[model samples]
Target chain A: MTLDLDTARRLIAGTRSAAHERGLKPLTVVVLDAGGHVVAAEREDGSSAKRFEIAHGKAYGAVSMGLGSRALMDRAEQQPYFIAAVTSAVGGSLVPVPGGVLVRDGDGTLLGAVGVTGDTSDNDEAAAVAGIGAAGLTAQPAA
Target chain B: MTLDLDTARRLIAGTRSAAHERGLKPLTVVVLDAGGHVVAAEREDGSSAKRFEIAHGKAYGAVSMGLGSRALMDRAEQQPYFIAAVTSAVGGSLVPVPGGVLVRDGDGTLLGAVGVTGDTSDNDEAAAVAGIGAAGLTAQPAA
Candidate 1:
């Protein structure tokens, strides 16, 4: 199923609120649909310029691999060369970071993924999880 | 000003409608903020897999150069070696095509750009112009 625009917007808003509540640095949030295409994205004022590209790379990696970026990070650690090859093949859009989370519907159908950047990786992951939850979706890491 | 999600969605919808009216091939549309960050994008069913990337490249080239892709195409034709070098420097994310158009506000402030693919260059440019107009924005080519 496709990731609806409303949910994507809600995810962005939720992520922003989560970051604000924690007093984290400005963030860039990106949501990619099931086809690994951008649905919505936002870069908060004062965010580092690279945050948007980082967020997009994380989301692209998650959707393209059908796994959360954390899972990719773990796999990359063991297979560095493989990840490097894949990154180069995809024009360097894969980011094996902790902040990319896969979104699933109630039936466990893949909806998309949300990627957050501009803070610690752990904090970014936490905000992404909260945002997915706020959008009434489950955040599932790859098994 | 940045390209907001609402305006991006409207642009996509407008482009889709234009394509349908003209019986063009399925299209992929991408919008980038003034900072050259993707704001939103959509790839219609039946569009080629690379359409999204092509659309994004067109939009990125437009916003990054502060000119429509048609203008870039003209320049590239006159300065092929320089354009090639610049495209290589940017990692091949620049598409100097007619489909990329700059978005501007009423007072002529650049907001972002819209790129359309999956049709003839002229048709794609027409759809992009229609999309920008539908969003209540101006589509300005470089002087």
Candidate 2:
């Protein structure tokens, strides 16, 4: 099923709850549709102004590359030039990091992605996973 | 005072209400801080994939130029080369148009700007105005 606005909002709520529980720094969360388009995005009050773009880039990259951003990070280390070129190719929305998690259905269908920022990359990924789980979906963050 | 996330979300809600009341097409709304950075953004379910970029550009142009985008539209018409140059200088986030309205405080202090897209330019501006008013803020659209 498509990622609707209600589900996207629920994801953001869950992400925020996770961050709050762990006392993470202020965060920005972005939810993207399968087409890599923003469905909803929210930035915490004290978050740096650039957080939205960074978070959006993370989600967009995950959805566009068809791989979790963590895998993209591994690929980036092996082929930095290729990742850099793809970043340019996507108009600078590809941020290879752990925070971008791919959303998937039970049968392995891609739904969309959720991106989180303003914490450590691992924390961000954990928060994204919590969010997707809260929405009753699976998160396919690559190893 | 900085524009908080709650206020920004309220603004978006009001914007959507206005668009819905007017029977406008699916819309995207973007809220930017005084620094011309996104605080929040949302794309309607059926909005085009490009709507977020366009809305953000409109708001960024308004906040960056210190004038509503309607005035920027006029300036663009009178000095296309200058506007074009500025657009490139801002990393292509300047969209000179009517849908961008400046947010202001009672004493005329600049707050931020909101951009709406998906309807006619005039209609979009109207929705922005309605949203700002709904949030108990003033809307400054350059004459």
Candidate 3:
């Protein structure tokens, strides 16, 4: 089933909760449905102005490429030109970063994606994983 | 002064409350700082996928023109070519229509803007005005 607004808000809250527990920097979180449309989003106070776009791009990339952004990062490293072209194809809304995670259901059905920005990329990934876990879903960060 | 995240959330809540009280359709709301950066944004469950972009464009257009989108609409009708060129100049992020209201402080300082979409444009503008009022800010929908 497609992600719903209630679940999207929960995902956003869980992401922020994880960041708060870790004492990480204020973050921006974005939840996108399987079709890469935003379901919900929030930016904590003090986050940089561009964090929303960065967070949205990460999640959009995950859904558009059908892979976690960590894998996208690997591909980018191996084939920069290819990634660049794909990024252009997506209207420059792809970020090859680790903070973007794919969400899946028990039946291995892709539900949506969550993207986080604020802390280091790895830390952001950790937060995203925690959020997905908190939402009772699986987070795929690579492969 | 710039609009903070807390106030932005309040405005969003207020906008939704107004829509609910009036039994309006599901809506998308966007808050943008004076610099035209997103502070916060949300789309209700049933809103169309592109509501966020439309809402954002309404607010961005208001702040960019230093007037409410109602005025922008008037200018667009009076000078279609100019509005069209300006829309292209802003990367096509300007929506000349109602439902985009400028936010101002007591001292008449421009703080930010709010955009709403889903219902009729007039109803959307009403909700936006209600939201700004709830946040204790003034809403300028014309001039």
For lDDT, the strongest prediction is 3
Off by over 4 Å in 3: none
TM-score of each model, in listed order: 0.74, 0.95, 0.96
User: What is candidate 1's lDDT per residue for B9-95, written digit by digit as tens?
Assistant: 788889888889989987878888898876666667667656778998888888878889999999988998877887877765888
State each candidate's clash count: 0, 0, 0
DockQ of each: 0.26, 0.58, 0.57
Q: CA lDDT of each candidate? A: 0.83, 0.89, 0.90
Poorly placed runs, candidate 2 (over 4 Å): none
In Å, residue A38's CA in model 1 sits off its true spot by 3.7
Candidate 1's docking class is acceptable
Off by over 4 Å in 1: A1-26, A33-40, A64-66, A74-86, A89-91, A106-111, A134-136, B1-26, B44-46, B75-82
In model 3 chain A, the worst 10-residue window by lDDT is: A1-10
Error of 3 at A28 (Å): 1.0
- The sequence of per-residue lDDT tens digits that candidate 3 reaches over residues A17-107 is 9999999999999999998987778888788888989999899999999999999999999999988899888875899989999999888
- For candidate 2, lDDT tens digit of each residue in B1-143? 27789988999999999899989988899998889878888888888888988999889899899999999999989999999899888876788889999998788888899999998989999999999999889998765
Error of 3 at B132 (Å): 1.3
